[model samples]
Target chain A: MATKIDEEQLMNDMLCRVKAVNNMPHDIRATLLDFKVDGYKVGKVRPGIAEMLCNMKTSVFELKQEDDSKKKSYLTLTSDAGTSSEERTKAVGTVMNQLRDEGFVKGWRDELFPVSENFYSPPVFLMERAAVTVLGVLEYGVHINGIVQESRQDEPKMWIGRRSATKSKFPGMLDHIVAGGQPSGISLIDNVVKECEEEAGIEESIVRAGVQSVGAISYENWDPKSDKLTRAVQFTYDLYLPPDFEPKPVDGEVQGFMLWTMDQVKESMAMDYADPIKPNCYVVIIDYLIRTGQISPDSNGFLDILRELRSGDCQ
Target chain B: MATKIDEEQLMNDMLCRVKAVNNMPHDIRATLLDFKVDGYKVGKVRPGIAEMLCNMKTSVFELKQEDDSKKKSYLTLTSDAGTSSEERTKAVGTVMNQLRDEGFVKGWRDELFPVSENFYSPPVFLMERAAVTVLGVLEYGVHINGIVQESRQDEPKMWIGRRSATKSKFPGMLDHIVAGGQPSGISLIDNVVKECEEEAGIEESIVRAGVQSVGAISYENWDPKSDKLTRAVQFTYDLYLPPDFEPKPVDGEVQGFMLWTMDQVKESMAMDYADPIKPNCYVVIIDYLIRTGQISPDSNGFLDILRELRSGDCQ
Candidate 1:
């Protein structure tokens, strides 16, 4: 009946509205436009837009303008039934509360800013970096912790989530569990410890003993919204575990967690993965672990950078 | 005064029209649309529309019901400004007569089509494969030949046309005459010698020694046209010559040609050359020569791919 809407088109339209409202200046217009274009959207939850809004809100607090001190929380109630009044109002209320508590939406009003949700559409065969983007964007704020299982006769193994098919943007996927959504500038080491306890049901003391090293992941993707596709930037961090660490799924979010040798991970990834987001994270994590002698990519033709990355062994 | 026309918008309009007219299939639509979005205008010529018309004509011919007896010609007419009408008509008649004599444009009158006069905007820079398409669509029937200048330490320097400032698509640029074009494939090797004679004004018996290699270059810029960009695929070959291969400017197409030592060419390209195109073409040629041991990239840090290709190298 209606034209099948595209994520890009929807974003372009929303950005045009923002421009119209602000009488958008050229430079600011470019940045906001970029965020909308490159931002991650899940139903009404746009991670990029949300991240920008959070940044803007934080900046407002820092500026300490006179108007900001007396900010009032804008709240509205909505039903969960098939009525706009209920669900929409509830969604706004949830955001308002989270923002006010986080100190971002002190004076923000509750308004129905219709968001066009984008579903995950991974490439037919995802490379490492692309896999990371898919996962990071889809599960923007989830925290995860995982263990690296090593054996003397074969490549090291790692335990991680077989993400819930219902919640997975990329269904039937498995990847390491690592911390996500700690406050932007907080120490990653602390966040990983907390994330392990919460995400994998491991205690902080156990996490402290198991935790190994911390490294970061960065990615670039073509974003048509900004008309500068190649320069779009996204980043992530990984938390590793020692050879003895074991993991158990703590909540409903994880469908199942698997203990996979490096070769198994590579082989399974090649078969099931279609985005670079998860593999990119694994590449960084595995590369770090292997380089440190915790694992080896070439032992069984698994963790080698040339094999895993260059030769597209996963594919 | 009319509003400034956005080249992107104009290209989009043209692409939409083409798609609608030909009922372009989905696969082709995606590729063509990608091109329209990424490309930019390279140049405009009086016979500018010839390229577009030729593409549209061929595609239409393909889409039409099967007609094996159909024939077509892609031709451009040029004459001195004061040529008589009869002479112009006679020229067209002679070409038509030749086509009939050759049996390439004879059987089906209704299906026989030629590139009649048409309007064309300058070639736009798309962020995709523009140059290759130009070769495929407009220059398909043309043949190309490659040649390399012999080491000329003992020969006299030559001059050809200075890079055409007004006529060149990429104005104020100079590039190596990598290959020369011919009307028929059979005479391509001869055309190489012919091009060296005309462009470099060298009459040496250029020998096609051996096939060195072939490579491709892809470059796209977002800020310039914000749409189209060019990707050039070059076929390079090495040629040998007598030690006394003297060179000089032989035609008006090129401003001047000169014989220079490797050091001199590098210095001229890096510091003395005034045209932008010359440097791009020179850099590639110099890099190739250096890698092949004909020159050096380290002497003055000039003509080095490592230096030139690194992000922010010039900056």
Candidate 2:
């Protein structure tokens, strides 16, 4: 017998996990300090992160509180860093290196991401990609859902990736067909073509013709250690594949690819509580299902789930 | 000559108009009171509405202020109203009738709308549909876009309706092919079918097969007078029509129907700023444009628009 599904619970659980701090009813986020760069409040970090940065004893960040309440505290880059983004980035980088040596930050990807208020805005500064999530920065990326449909009778089949076992993150877990962090210099569509080719062995011409940018799913996650806030905006897309197309794994980012019927995708996402797809990308699939008219509007918590999908600082 | 479009400005203006109190830099909502029923904050009303309700001195409401500042005041249903939803509804209904008589309310639809925190929940009370918006409540409705796309070379054409001049609200304005409020008994899909047949003379079989529940666009609008708050969740859908199918205005609700290509539709929505489509339905169209990928991922304020599309209390 197949396991029964509590779809509302599954969705609520996923949303709460993906946007832990946002789903709270009370102002529990007051415990977190506003993280400022060059005097502009851009992100947030836990009290522990504030203390850690302060203990580094650098003039980089000045942590202050209000009215005898630690709850009202904030950390801002000092005037010493000045207004030049380059100077601020270099100053922050020096502190980050010290943090790495002291074992406070890890997983250095060497890829740098610009920190900004929104995706298309000018950067406040640049930070190492891997450290972006760990240091509570707003990160943006693209995720696409590839599917095949000849007609309604066949029930459109969607393509999903299983991360390689040796991968550093989300290993052996299911994910979207093509996903990558947004680095400076490349256009979003061009980046989509590049990632599609590198991750799924899809041709550039096919990707350019097939892919369509839908929108975005933003989430605010409290890292497992509960000391960092990871805010992410996944720019979503939908790619209609030729019925006969098959995706072979090109790079080791993904272990393998499989085509799942709409039913199978729903089952994996809604019923696979034992292990779900990467929490953030999991929401993108639900969004795709909704857009394709698979998820009924009468489903309980439909409104809540739709809103929570973009629950973070969506801009 | 075609008018150049400032898509970002158009969307921002529509969103600001639809969700006025929401798109603020700070919480101007502090001016409004939490309208409570059965001790639950089910809605929010302008301070004027609160005072108007209490002025009657009917023992139905007891307004309280916090910190001697009106900022934190809430109007609650007195204990005399009891916990019986039916009794509370009857008591509130009596007041609604009186308010209508005194000209504080208008447009009695003779339709009843349930009061609850979210859809698919038991009612806290049932109020007249017309007063639901004037009195501040979360209203639910369904809107669908009907389109025909035979191939890639031909841009998809969508069917839109022009409201009859005789209608009281948004007369002669552009609207979706089929849209209706969610009543108490019918299923959402069934509501779509009923509205489709009644408004567009579409056959039941065709609507049942072609129409789909895509998702929702919720917005919070402060009425033109900036008094009442109208929080609405419009469940959206997409219906694929046969290439030859054309919608005829039925039941005198619509003046006529027009089929516009995607470019035409985008132009009407993005460029016709002097006289735009109905504000709430306008949001539904932007959502459709995004889902179909007509709006690029790199558009400025892409993230903000996506989030604000469902800017109301979605649940």
Candidate 3:
């Protein structure tokens, strides 16, 4: 018989991956460059940007001495540079170009992500999504998982995919059927449909008919490798597939797809408690499991899992 | 034309009531008496107890000198006292009796609540449920709401209760059909069934047949009146009632019951944004609304609500 899974251990493992960034060392905290327009914070530059600017001797920005002890010293654009959204976007673009030249940011993408006072508000400016993390700006992502259940089945199975080995992040790890960041200018539903077609070869008609928005999970963590404070909110969706349907990877991004019973999925999650599932994807799965009653209230660590899944808000 | 409900405002109202206690002032924090056994913290005493012990000249506990900067100074039992679960319980019982005599606790309850390292673990000891909040220990509550939906109805209605004005806490506020804290030794399902029968006069068989555990919501707050840091986790359940079924208030705790459409519930929640529903009941309803798709993912403040509902984790 398989050893019983320790619910507390599983929950701790999941939370360790998504721990919130509430306390930062003064040195690490000092390196962040806050970008403000009209006294409102819109974005931030990742740590080590001060050194880069010093080496380049850029006259585009200057550090403002912070009078408030609580506020970190931030770089402000020169008065000659306008503070309009377009002007600020252009200034950030120039900074990104300089950073790229210095080999800080790799393979820059043109796709823009929103910089808003709050996640639900309208964007003040659209910065390149690829560069937003390097800037330590909060980003939003959308993930849709196909819960394909056969007719008359008591327990529903799910369609899961493994990322292609060639993928830059979390290669060979398990992922949802369709997942992508919420780049600026694209509606969430439109993005979901596009991801479904490109990543899993699911027809647009099937996806549109079956997709249902379940909920979202938010988490903020300090990415050690990039030295950036990554704040993200993932909109989760459930697409119910018909019994005869199977997902095939059209794009090379997904290596393979498999339908696993809920038990098998639980076992996979248990077995890979250390590092198999993508960190954010693990949170989505845990949310789905708790919502669907696969993880009963009586289960140990059920409350802990519920609390940790939304650790982002605390930050 | 019906006015559009301000979703963001409604969510903010709900969140404000359940805001987690993040920072405690030193004066307030100094009052809590920690209870530990074998170096593991099991429970805590509320503020003002130090004065009571001092006035009473109690020899039960002595304040330990702090050596580690990170560790909070705590009150440990005198060396004469035993550290066994039974002995510690008895010792706390003496403290409770002394407190009751001094009017620190009112209306002593026989129902014992679990004292655990965390919400999910087995209890180290059982203390009176009514005194759990007064003791500043984390407590768990269960809330089962009856979702009575008519066949072919697009919007399902819920059975809601108005608490009796004569009741002590949250008197005359709107509440779920059935809700109660988890007392030691009682199973969750058993508590759900018992609460249904007592609170709503629902037959036990019907509840057992239709009740399903949906998910849970957690929140922590510092209760100023009790001068205690209160942490709570609510296990939510949905009981699908027949369309024609009506809940009758069998117990005097509830003044009356009414079935309202989902839109009406939303309107009530929006109208009484400040203090209409019982604070914890509002959280359960929000969870229900989001899960049922009544609160669409595209709705304003939807993600913020998701984040705030689980804010208890970071505490």
Candidate 4:
């Protein structure tokens, strides 16, 4: 029969067992311990660690000083901190220590934690189809349809689009038309057109026709190593102009209006591109018009001639 | 004194150890073993089995069969695999039986096996940079400076370009006019101008007088997991032209050639308009040129017709 281990002794014994089971060398074990403690102080642990510990065949509880008394609670290895290796290491230590010191190791052997279920395992043949993901952009234009005579103002005002409140990702800035991907026969163009109408409050079914322009942009953000700011096969399409293109701003998302010509709109876009005005909107719309020759290439073009002028040779 | 383990017994003991160490229950161990034996065997089996055995700390060696008196081999797990409960179960019947029958388990224990080195340690923070990995074509266009006489069919054609290959990731495409990227820069235009003359063998002293076009396109055959593709921001410029500009195409990468008008090149880009030509090469170049007004809109004003058609009210 094995000697009854005290909580601290049990924890130390389990740690030794963990090292042996994991086949980790002495140096590596020390490194892992240091890494775990430091990671715990800072929040950067993956939630998976808690699940891993919970599944281990050991019952562990942690004691914390509560006022004058010590309160006992089951130990879990989870932190809101970023999921870095250091954080993971700390979580492992905290859980192991709690369970060992509590003398719950034997109890854990009697209880079983939930095991993760396996999803579908596809064969290798479906690799190509599985790899493809789609990305796209819906381009709208502020057309100078006709000059409206303002009842109060002396100047002839051109009808312009109202500013959108949903500038970033919101009900409309970015919305998931479909939470999960459709299986087949999904036309990207039709989907984009539908999404714009739903999110941007575009009423008309003016699909951007013709192959006007194409290009790529890089996107990057920190956090979640597994997450990437990429959706391959992203396409941009300009909206078709409808005769009764009356746009009523969507409630809560879009705020009301501004009337400006091609020049004023361009200038506003130039002033502060990513301003409340949404500069990329202007770039996409202008590019479409220029390519179709609906608008003249404002002398120097959309790419600011003055800047290019400073640089030698156009090529 | 420790009991002497024969070859088969030694292998069986090791398999049992590995199972215990990995915490694989008996049911899972059975499943894994069955799967390894027959569930998947599309390609080479020996190497795959070797890889799996290596993970289990198993030693597979060649032995001489008594019947044939020729070299044969058997596999056995080492003592290092003993720490895991999961590994222990898997090794019980198969290799351990062989080791005991052969009576070579003691000799196997004496043989030194190489240990696996830890190459990948999880990093403290995953700091990764954004990579632009593909090129796209918006549109394609050509400009002509002077009229080509019918009699000058045999006249030596000229092409403007660099003599030697410039430094670029995609050296196979435009050898002299290399593509470069400036991740952090004031403007994409500024970076493009700097790269042009340096890579294309153009004189930097001459200023780019006008703004051309801003088009859009996207990439292809890019994989985020593999990170195999090279990406760079590209700025296409009109090799500064005068009123009486002549045709010229430099050798090496860009060989000498006569300049063609938009009409002559329209057919080539026709593939992009349709799906015949891959979208990137044709559509990207065409869209950029047309958006810039390098080639004026088609005579019929196809864009206007398209807009009118979309606007049902317009005649």
Q: If both were scored by TM-score, which would come out higher, candidate 2 or candidate 3? A: 2
Once fitted onto the true fold, the runs of candidate 1 whose alpha carbons sit more than 4 angstroms away are A1-154, A223-245, A271-315, B1-315
Ranking by TM-score: 2, 3, 4, 1
For model 3, name the residue pairs that clash. none
Summarize candidate 4's per-residue lDDT along A118-222 as a digit string, tens digits: 011111111112111100011111122222322211222333444444443332231111111212223433455454454345543343421122221111111
Q: TM-score for candidate 3, please give it.
A: 0.83
C-alpha displacement of B44 in model 1, angstroms?
32
- Give the per-residue lDDT digits (tens) of candidate 1, residues A34-144: 121112222111235434434543221111112245442211111321134344334434444554576533333332222212211321111122222211222123233
Encode model 2's per-residue lDDT on A79-184: one tens digit a residue. 7766788988888888887777777677777777898766777898887776765457888889999978754434677898888898877789888888988888
Models ranked on DockQ: 2, 3, 4, 1
TM-score-superior candidate, 1 or 2: 2
Q: Each model's DockQ? A: 0.01, 0.68, 0.47, 0.03
The Cα local distance difference test for each model comes to 0.33, 0.75, 0.70, 0.28
Candidate 3, residue B10: lDDT:
65
Residue B113 of candidate 1: its Cα lDDT? Answer: 16
Please, what are the lDDT tens digits per residue for candidate 4 over residues B36-59?
A: 111111111122333433443244
Off by more than 4 A, model 2: A1-26, A64-73, A151-154, A224-226, A270-275, B1-26, B57-59, B64-73, B79-83, B151-154, B224-226, B270-275
Compose the digit string of candidate 1's lDDT tens values, residues B190-294.
555566676665554443432232221112221122222222222233343334544455665556544444443333432323532332344344324432333
Model 4 DockQ, alpha carbons vs. true complex? 0.03
